[model samples]
Every structure is written in C-alpha cells, then in structure tokens.
Target: MKPLSIITLDQISDALDSIDLLGEMRSAFIAYSSGRSVIPPVGELIIDEQPPGEVHIKYGYVRGGAHYVVKIASGFPRNQELGLPPGNGMMILFDVSNGSISSILLDEGQLTDVRTAAAGALASSVLGVPGARVGIIGTGVQARLQAVHHASALDRDDLMVWGRNLGKCSLLASDLEAHGLKVEIAESAEELAERCRTIVTCTASHTPLLTRPMIQPGTHVTAVGSDTPDKQELDPRILGSADLVVVDSLSQGLVRGEVARSIDAGTITPGRVVELGQILDGSNPGRSDPNHCTVADLTGVAVQDLFIAEAVARSLV
Candidate 1:
C-alpha cells in the first residue's frame, strides 16, 4: 500500500477553492448537529506551554453524503521560535460505508485558516444583514481570509479594517483595495464596528477587542478569535444584548474561556445560544429581524476540519 502523501498549505488552499468548501462546510455542520457524527473534546492552552492542551477530534459522514473524515489538531504556542505556526495538524478521509483511508492531508496554517474563513462566510450568508458594509478587526492571515470569504459570500465590495498597529492595517487595506475592494483603515475596532453592519473579528487577543456601543442595531458579528480559553474578542455586554448568539459547537466553546467566562459571569445563558448547524438545518431561526443583533462565536470545530479534508482528498483524486 502506498503511504499517505504529505500535503502542504498551498495545496490545501488550492483544493479548498476548487471544491467550494464553504457550501460543503455548511452542509457538514447541519449534519453534525443532527447527531450524525462523533465530535471529541477540545482542550485549550495545550500548545501554549500552559497547563493543558487544546485537542479536538471528530468523525462524521455527510448525510446522503458519500464520505467520512476525521481530524486531530493541536495548537502549541512554542512553535513561534522556529518561525512556524503554533498550530500543526493532519486529517484522514475515509469511504462512507466501510471506513477505509482514502487520503491524508497534512496542513498547519492553511487548513485552519481556510476552514475558519469558510465558517465566517457561511455565517455571513445565513445571518449577516443584507447589503452590509463589512468591517474587519485584524490584519493577520486569518483577517485576510475573512475579508476574501466575506466578499465572496456577500457580494460586498466595501470593507473597513482596523488594527492596533496602524501600518499593518494600512498595508492590509491597500492589498484588499488592489483586489477590487473599497478598503479603509479605521482608528479602532469601535470605529469599524460603528461604520459597518457586518463585523468580523479575527485577532489573537486575550481581552475584549470590541464593545456593545460600537455595534449598531441590525448588525451581525462573527468572532473568529478565542479558539483558546484565554482569548476573547467581543465584550460580555455584546453577548447579553444579542438577539441570537450562534456558536459553531456548544461543547467546544464551553471549553474555551470566551463563552465560559460570559456564562460564568451571568452575562449570557448557555440555553439562549444556538448552534450554527441548527440554524442551517432550520431547527432554529437565524436572523428574525434586520433590527436585531446577532453574534456567532466560533472556537473552531473538528467537523469543519474533517469536511475540508474530504474535499481536498476528492480534488486530489
């Protein structure tokens, strides 16, 4: 038997684009919520040289879907010294009925970034306000992916960005503008939030990066940071005021300190939250009114990783 071929981030990116991964991820999430998959525990700070590790594993087959995939990934903060990402991972794709390895995908930064951006795109398409003026609250790689995905999903051309470091934000704005987007750099997350109806936060902060007052009524926010327990990008008040707070997975977020802190503080109730998969399945309504606030808290999910792996495998065949 031939050994699984090792794949790189660039290959993953090409595969992701070719397979229309956003739609695939959306369908996979809905099936995941319907009890069709086994999602494992996610441990945060494992990679940070902290107390524990953040590990996630999941196995699932698309409903009326032909394939299954499982992914295991870990984020270790110490990798920075090697000029490498703290996160490194691989995925296994299998045949649906009889579980057999179809392909293996080896990716670190590329896999996570693509799937994360796809989730934001799915959320934007399903819940963002119509004709939204988008705002980005970071200029990192994930931020760039978020900008592209939002543009694809919303047909939006207007984007405003902000970063603590003005030079980085300015450079990012220029890059996006070159991509045919109307990009602007704002002074703060508050300013970006105030100017756009759809806001996406993709930062690596341990504290709140945005507040409630910055958000207008009818705004939709997708918080892509906070994959670890110690990181949070949105204020607790925003959680309390949201008409709907959608998360990629309930079990996953509770492990991360972001939602757990809010829940522990009594600022938000776990019962009031809905999974993005449930919303996609029509089990719960996504956005009931244009005048309401909605928040999608994403801590990342194994299901997404698996789905993307399957897509990449198929493209390779």
Candidate 2:
C-alpha cells in the first residue's frame, strides 16, 4: 500500500480557487448525464437527526480516468453549539487500475461547499435572468458561497441573504460587504423570495422553509439543501409551479431532493423534471423565458465531488 498524500484544507482552498470550477462542474455534469461517467446510488447515514445532520458516502469514476474518488461528507447543525463548524469530512482518491489509494483530501468539506456553490452558479448561468437580484436562504457557509459564486458566475451584483437567525444573517451580510459584495438581510425566507428575483435555499431543515405563496412568478430557485430524504428546503408546491425544473442528475433527484418529495406527493411527474446536463448538452432548453419560474434541485452528485477532488489531487501531484 502506498502512503496516501493528505491534502489539507488550505491546499484544498487554494487549489479550488485556482481553477475554473464552475466550468469544470458543468463538464462533469454533462459527462455524468450523457452516460459518459459512472455514478452509483449514494450511501447515507444520519449522525444526528434533531437539527438534521448526516454523513454521505459517495463514490464514482469518470470513464477513461486513471483514478476514482470516494468522498465522505458530514454536516451537524449542533457543531456550532459545540463551537465548531457544522460541516466536516474528506475525499479519498484511488488508482483505478489496481485499486490502491492514491490520495486523501482532508478538505473538511470545503470541496463540497465549493462544488455546491459552483452548481448554484452553473444553474444561474443557464437560467437566471439578466441583471437579476440573487437571494440566499440560510446564514451558513453555503449562503455565503452562493452569494459569492452566483454573483461571479452570473455577473449579477445585487444580492440578499435570509436566515432564521438575524445575528448570523447580519454577520454574513457584513462579511460580504467587507469584500465589496453588497448584500441585504431579509427578515425571513418568505420575504427573501418575494423581494429578490432569484433565490437559493441552503438550509438544513427537515421541513420546507420556502413555500409556494411566498414565491413570486418568474423566480429562479436553486435548492441546495435537502440531500437526505428527511431534509427539504423548498415546499413541494414550489416544484409544482416551476415552468422548468432541473436537477444535477435525474436519478439522484428522484430519490432524495425536493423533486423526490414532489414526486411522492404527485405534485410533479418524473418526466417534468430534467437534468441540468440536458440543458448544457443542448438537448433541453433550460429556461427560455426570463419571466417564467425555474427550479433546480441539487442533491450533491458524486460526479461533482469526483471531478473537483480529482482536479485538486492533480494540482498537488
């Protein structure tokens, strides 16, 4: 067995910042959805269900690659109560030929955060309205990165953030402000959806935080949370109202995301939900009208982690 190269969080952040992540993510999605990559069903384990935190074990290899990746990402809402970050985990790379471990990315789940935000930006790039204001629900790492990556990728400056905690929301806004990214704090998720043109719900709630009536017509929503069956951020009715709904992958979305909940309730059919790759591959037009509501549920596909983790590993070696 070879000694595994451990890539630290600092290295992970630097490597991620040094690449065209959103572009890479787009390519990975295209490959995954186009049958060019291998992504099996995700394995999950709930560590704490109270505030709803769980660990996901994802593994896959892109065809024609020398290495594959297996990532274990965990999120615990009580971590903050323990004075630690709510997310922690790592990704391991293996040489496909002999199944030997190649490297370990101890990113502390920063890679997931980056990839998730990159997916948000990708969805916005394809479906977001021009000069539209972006809104983020939740005051966690995802909320901050959504504003950062979405603003950069979509080239939209106006942004707002909403959360159940005013202090956290204000702090997030202030941090973004210090970086020249102006953001306002919304009183609630409902207010954020009504006031902002585009919204991304990044909460860890087991219940729906953003409902149907709170959303206005022509809104673009990227639901980044709810990767587990027990966790949902957007109300299923919102999925029923969307003119077009996209997912990182159809298979994953049908089982765990808001799409799953919507499907189970018969609010929307499986055929109604499409993969974002189809939009990128020119097979499906994502959102044709700027005034039509669109929704994209991202349940954190393995291809994303595979692509980015491999990229980070390559940069190091």
Candidate 3:
C-alpha cells in the first residue's frame, strides 16, 4: 500500500477552475441518465441539535471508468451564526482497477459548490429563453457562484437578488456588481420571480418560499435547495403550473427532492419529470417553446461527485 494523496481544499478549487464544470457535468448527467453510470440511493443523516442540519452520503461509479467516488457532504445553515461556513464535505477516490484507495480530497464541499453552480449554468442555458433576466434567491455561496456562472453562460450583465437578510442581499449585489453584472435587490422572493425570467433558489428552507402565481410565463426556476426530504424552497403549485419540469436524477428527486413533495401533493407526475441527461444527450428537447415555464429540480447526484473526483484526480500528480 502506497501513500494516499491527501489533497487540500485550495488544490481542489484550483483544479475546479481549470476544467469546464458544465461540460464535465453534462457528460456525467448523460451517462447517469442513460444507464451508463451506476449510482445508488443517497444515505442521509439529520441531526436535530441546535444548529439543525443534515449530512449526505453518496457513492457512484461511471461504467468502465478507472476511478469511483464516495462523498460525505453536510450542510448546517445556522453555522453562519457561529461564524463558520454552512456547508462542508470531503471526497474519497477509489481505483477500480485494483480496488485500492486512491486519493482523499478535503475540499470541504467546494467541489460540490462548483459542480452545483455548473449544473445551474447548464439548466439556464438549456431551459431558459433568450432576453431573460436572471434573478437569484438566497444570499449564500451558491447564489454568488450561480450568478457568476450563469452570467457568463447566458452572456447577460443584469441580475436580481432576494433574501431575508438585507445585509447579505446587499453584499451579494455588490459582489456580483464587481463581477460586471448589474445586480438589483428585490424586496421579496415573489418580487424577484416577477422581475426576472430565470430564478435560481438556493436556500435551506423547510417550507415553500416561491409560490406559483408569482411566476410568470416563460420563466425558468432552478430549485437547488431541496436536497432532502424535509427541505423545500418552491411551492408545489409552481411545479403543477410549469410546462416542463427537469431533474438531475429521476430516482433521487422522486424520493427526497422538491419533486417528491410535488408528486406527493398530486401537483406533478412522473411522466412530466424529465431527466437533464435527456436534454444533454439531445434525446429530449429542453425548451420546446420560448414561452414555456420550465422548472429544474436538481437534488444533486452521486454521478456528479464521481465526475468531479475523477477530474480532480487526473489533475493531481
């Protein structure tokens, strides 16, 4: 047994910057959706302590690939009150050829942040129409990353931000403004929805925040907050009104994602849910018409971790 390549968070971030996250994630989504990748159901642990958070255990492998990944990610929203980051995680790589432990990436969820934002970019590029302004909900790392990524992907200079905390919302606007985007602040999530054609929700709220009537025609909603059974950021009625609803993984989303709640409430159907890989692989048209309301529920997938780990591992010495 040789030594494990203990990679640091900075190293992983640098690696992430070097690759095209959307491209890599597109391939992974295609493979996983097309049955070319194997991913089991995610394991979740919820701690009901003071902070109140959840940890996710995910593992998956690309068929015939050299390496696989197992990721343990956690999100504690109240950690900000303790002057710490809300999300943290690590990834372990394994060599399929020898069944040996390959490397350990202590990214502390940085890769997750990047890949998730990349997925948002993908969703925006595919499901949203041209001439649409981007609106963001939640003033967290994901809101910043997604705005930066989506601004570049959509080639737009305008966006809007909404959050319960006025300070954080202003901070996000300033940050994105420095990135060359004309960022505005919305009084509420509903106002944000009405003002922009594309809305990205990234909060950890346990209740619905964005409702149906607030969303207009031709709007695209990217729901990234509902990764577990207890979390929901979009109202179920919104899914019912959407012309098209896409998810990263049908299996995962149907069980523990926002889509699950929508399904349970009889607002949506399995037949209406389309996997993103279908659009990535050109099997299904992403947005049939420019006026269609599209909602993408990305609960995060194990294949995403496998893809990112493989990319980072290849870049390591």
Candidate 3 colliding pairs: 89-108
Return the lDDT, model 3, position 16. Answer: 74
1-317 in candidate 3: lDDT tens per residue? 55679889888878877887888889889999889888989988889998698889999888888777899999887988999998899999988777789899998888888889999888888889886999999899999999998888899989999988899999999988888889989998888988899999988788998988899999999989788887899999999989999999999988977899999999999889999999989999889888899999999998998888888877876
The runs of at least 3 residues in candidate 1 whose Cα sits more than 4 Å from the true structure, single-residue gaps closed, are 1-10, 43-45, 48-87, 94-100
Top TM-score model: 3
lDDT of 1: 0.79
lDDT against the true structure, per candidate, is 0.79, 0.87, 0.89
Candidate 1 total steric clashes? 8
For residues 1-317, could you state the per-residue lDDT of candidate 2 as single tens digits? 77779889888888876788988899889988889788899998875557777788999988888778899998887889979998889999999888998889999988999999999888877887777789999888998998899889878777889888889889999989987887888877878888887888888888899888998878999999788777788888989989998999898888888999999888899999899999999999788887899999999888899889888888877
Best-matching candidate per lDDT: 3
Show where candidate 2 strays beyond 4 Å.
1-4, 48-53
Q: Every model's Cα RMSD, please?
A: 3.0, 1.8, 1.4
The stretch of ten residues in a row with the least summed lDDT in candidate 3 is 1-10
lDDT of 1 by residue, 193-293 (tens): 88888988988888888887888999999988777666888888888889999898888767674577688668898888889999999999889999999
Reference-based TM-score of each model: 0.88, 0.95, 0.96
